[model samples]
Target: MPVGFWVFPWDIEDEGIDRFAARLDELGVTSASPSVLYHSGRALLPRAREHKVRLLGGPGANYPFESLETPLAGMESASAPGTGKRFWQGLAEARSDRGIRLNAWAMPMHGSELGRRLSVAVVRNCFGNPYSYALCPSHPQARRFAESLVGELARSRIFHAIQLESVGYLGYRHFHHHEAEYVGHGPLEELFLSLCFCDACMAGARREGISVVELRESISRDLERRWRDDVWSVGVEDVREALAANDDLQAFISYRQATVASLVSSLAELCHSESTELHCFSAIFPPTLEHSTWIEGTDFAAWSRVLDRLIVFGYTAGGPGAAKVDEGWTRSELEYAGRYFDPSRVNVVLNLAPQYLATLDDARRRFRTISEMGFNDLSITNYGMTSETRLDWVPELGRVLDAPASST
Candidate 1:
């Protein structure tokens, strides 16, 4: 299992590169995966290599759904064509470099009308619904756009693998649309709010005989009624005015997960043609959040056959229980994930911040346990997000990286 660190090169300058590379070398860390960015007509891969860190070329955190900004709408005419071109060139350079491996990390179905803010209203109006923030996997245009984008990226020849992310619906889409759907239902009832009710979404669902109008209307009415009843029972009868605001957060998780699976299947086909390896990283929450919806919707089975690797997000900072390193939890999660895809293809991202250097021991243990469970690769969260103190954690991380994977 090869281990690597993640960094943001968008802000990394030549001097900063020297410092970072020095740190990595001192810690005996070799390969590095930095965020993709083109600056001043040049990419950062060369500088990183000068520091002796292998660069993984990528758009960093570019989300496919939100890629369409009005100013940079559409794949062909997307923002800063030169940025991508420079990145491709960087990929070529990295390929020539001794240690780098360039991969396109794509956030597949991550929809956030909230993040788009001003533009979201336009998207909602155009799609004829405010709730349809995520691109409907059932939608042809979404698939076309995704395929075109991947094709264009693959043309660079610098990328050896394609990393898929989010690939699920918005984190809060279900919450925004269907809080009432589960009203009058069991408190613990499972909810996976399904989306894509726009013309495109509905039409796509029709192919499978799923009714868009009925589903939306049902949710709208159910939640509204439940809210009204709950208010009246509490003698807050005047609260009908706020009835429209009621929504279940869990529903968003459900919808997001389903969309992930659909989009992954579609994108996997596109990546395969280019002979590029496909990988996916979780977007919604850390594994401890118990996001089974994401796992099921973006079925690892679909990816295992087509993808070259699978990277699951095991964020610990806000993870349930003790954010502290719990090897038992890490082991269980890795073992569970190992059941889905080849252990070698699976990697766990350990988010480390320099500010959290005090937790280095815990974080290292988490990585060790995960790697021991058969995962070979480890992705450190972000270079930019790390603090000076967090930088202190690098040496300990190097030790964990060098430790042999558990034999069991």
Candidate 2:
């Protein structure tokens, strides 16, 4: 298997590029996917070198690109201040010296700064409340920002591939710190709440022959009823039933898928033109058309035509007892992805945290399972957050993953 380590700019800066590259080499890592465009956050220590918390911004950007020179109207630049080593330059140097492939990891639409500043461009719930953390992908300005960002990254020419994250509409639920909102929200409710009915999205739906007005009213009525605790058990099946019954709802869903596909296709073109391959990191699992389309606006079939590879999160560590369940989930995801994209290009990212995997044995088992599934590419969730002891598993896991396939 081709093993890649997911790293952050600060991780490289603190450890020093040479040392970091050497360590990865020792661990038998074949590639490095470093974050180039990322959201605001601080890295936890013990696992990370002593470094100050990064107050949410793209830290690696130093040189001015014409695409990002002029700020989008009503939005602030989320680029972190260039105070120390330039990320792209350092990464390029390390790649040259260490001979490891670099894949630029970027988050296109998940900038909280842009969403907070341009509330109108953010995703809105059925109650017309804006999620000021996720930029609505259908927003014209948001799409332009994403395209320009991708173009600039491709032009940088430092990456073997560009991995995009959060390139679709974000749902209501998130892993935000200190989140305390408890509204008895179920999966179906979260799905309903995630649907963006912003002006751009509504207009797009209308263009796709959807009755936006009727759709909006229907959603509003359902939300109102749910808010009052009047509905009993709203689940994925309920959402499916609604889609089956309502033409407008179905059209709106189709429009969402098309919106995301169009953006990805445009980015793919820019990347290809610049001689950079495009990859996507999506949370939409099982790779089913309906689940991917309705939940996250991802169309795997459409993406397969453009993306060089697709990496899906297979962190299935609910607890020690959930190993079998995790394996089943991971298998299903890889199997589904193989239906659209080649198995060689479908990578599964595993979580190495103790909470996700209790022991090294568990990690070894999971790694072997992924290899047995015929996936040639494997990645770990993160390097910055993994402990020193846990880091030891990389080389061992690499050995297991790199082993030749067994004869039946």
Candidate 3:
């Protein structure tokens, strides 16, 4: 079993790598995935040497590659640690001595600053309004940029694995800063609005013989009905079921998945050349969890063969009031994903947040359930974000998952 934590460079550098690795070693953590690149986010660190509770990462990879003439739109690599030692070098040091496997976490297209700065065609809604946070893979510039960055990371040969995240289409409702919405839509509405009809996506769909005009009209009508009537109109609760009633919708979705898969296939080929395992985050538009990656253009049928591992989210915690999550939710989601993905090539990410796994007992029970599911590869939600008390559950989690585990 491989047990690890998803952490940022600041997470390790905040307290210094030696101290951070010592903590992980004490908790029996086998792997540490430090973000080589990421999008924007605010984090709360429990063991910070400074600003224990402060703004965290943003878009860009700031280390010393000197690849670009000017820095990315944000603070040049997602709030890099302004410490004496560089994160990559310290990470290598920690890995060499602490036996911690370094997973290079990179967000390919999910960057608010970089996307806006580079003027890449991001995912646009049926109305043609850009989401700004996501770059469409169909765009040549976006594809080339992602390929160059990821290829560089793989060639570095410092990481045990290259964990690719947000390598596919992203959706609306990303919980942006002070984000607001009136629709309060469920799966269908969110899915329709999240569909990208940008020029790049449009041209690709047309080449695939998909009718963008008809699809747009279909989505418009559905949204109009949903907005005014407060119903899905088709009375279908599940996204798969709803999409089944429409051939164009299904075909467009398939095209999106194929585009994403093709990009990953290229990246995987590059990683293979460098002897680095390529793992992708099977995520996007949650409440759908494992089943919903399709909405964001990631599909096991398309990516499983090419990817070294597909990471799926199954949260038992952090759900809306008690009404959303139940005892069987995580198991059901994992079961659905297991039906499609090879267990040997899957890593299930569970929450370590206190709201979900409050105590050592909760961590123990969750670990046992996941272990029984035959998912030997597992990752906890994060390191810096979880509270001090909640992080104490790590030791118990390690005791339960001491065999093997990893994260990014």
Candidate 4:
């Protein structure tokens, strides 16, 4: 398994490129995924020589782009992707000297700056309220903008591959800063709330002769009634049952998946034309990890046909809702993934922090398990968020990954 790290620009800039690349070498890392575009957040960088805390927002052109021509004009990059000329210069050196394959990572169709643009409708709920964090890919302008970003990243000539994140429909859980939703919406409720009812979605449904108007009304009424109910509990079993029962709802979901798949195909075609590899982090934002990428309109079968590699966060692995993460969890997830994607085309990332792996033994055991499976590529969560102690886990895991058992 070829290993890589999902890194931020700040990580390179703050740590200096030589030191950064050296860390990768020490960790036996062969590839690097650096963010070209990222969401707004304040990150406490542990190893930074300069400022420890960095605030990131907006698009950037650290690598020689002509102009700031996208939807984000005045919004200059606060945590600029590559810190001016020094970053590119250092990155070029790293590539030439280390043979590191650089993956230009970008978050598409999930930016508030792009979503709130005048021409974009963003994603809307059944109640028709806009989700500012999401730019509906079904929107013409948004689709074109996504094409523009991918095209530019592909054409940049600096990357061997381009990784796309949040490339589909985002829902109620795609939260903005300081978010507080007092009302508790269950997993099923959140999924319904996340469903887009924007003009583009409506049009797509209408084209299929779906009674969208009545469907929306039915959804709104049901959600309202549920909120007013004193006791409402929906477990994982309720999700598939509900979808099976509601034909119109199922129709809308199918349309969303088709629309997203179309967008992914076009982007993949664009990347191929530019002679760049395309990989997408196809996992949906959770509360519904059981459905994987399905909940957010990403049809894995459709994606399997197009994407050069589909990256999934196997963060939760078990039965429905990941209710029990037993020893067979990873094997079960791989089997489930085989239904949609070839195991060879999958890149599974392990969140090496305390949040997921939790211990050195757990990390080592999981690494050996996946490596012995021998088909999927493995990527560590990141260089930026991980502490030095956690990063120490990579060298051992990396060695285990390269063993004969994983060479099949």
Q: Rank the models by TM-score, top first.
A: 4, 2, 3, 1
Model 2's alpha-carbon lDDT is 0.74
| Reference-based lDDT, each prediction | 0.49, 0.74, 0.75, 0.75
Question: Which sections of candidate 4 miss by over 4 Å?
Answer: 58-70, 81-86, 284-289, 316-330, 404-408
- Residue-level lDDT for 77 in candidate 2: 28
TM-scores, each model vs. reference: 0.68, 0.90, 0.90, 0.91
lDDT of 2 at 195: 88
Give per-residue CA lDDT, model 4, range 237-322, as digits (tens).
66777789889888888898899999999999999998998998775443254544567888888988999998876566433433
Supply the TM-score for candidate 1: 0.68
Q: After aligning candidate 2 to the native by TM-score, how far in Å is the CA of 6 from where it should be?
A: 1.1
lDDT of 4: 0.75
| Candidate with better TM-score, 2 vs 4 | 4
Over 4 Å off, model 3: 56-58, 68-75, 83-86, 230-241, 285-290, 316-327, 402-408
The regions of model 1 sitting more than 4 angstroms off are 13-32, 36-84, 91-96, 111-133, 173-194, 229-262, 287-291, 316-321, 325-329, 354-358, 404-408
Question: Per-residue lDDT of 286-342 in model 3, one digit per residue for the tens?
Answer: 454335667778878778778888887756446444223633676777777777776
What overall lDDT, based on C-alpha atoms, would model 3 receive against the true structure?
0.75
Where is model 3 poorest over a 10-residue stretch in terms of lDDT?
66-75
Residues 120-225 of candidate 2: C-alpha lDDT, one tens digit per residue: 7888877788887778889988888788878877888878888887788888764444567545666666667778999999888878778887888888888778
Residues forming the 10-long window of minimal summed lDDT in candidate 1:
118-127
lDDT of 1 by residue, 153-202 (tens): 55545567666554544333233322444343321112212333455544
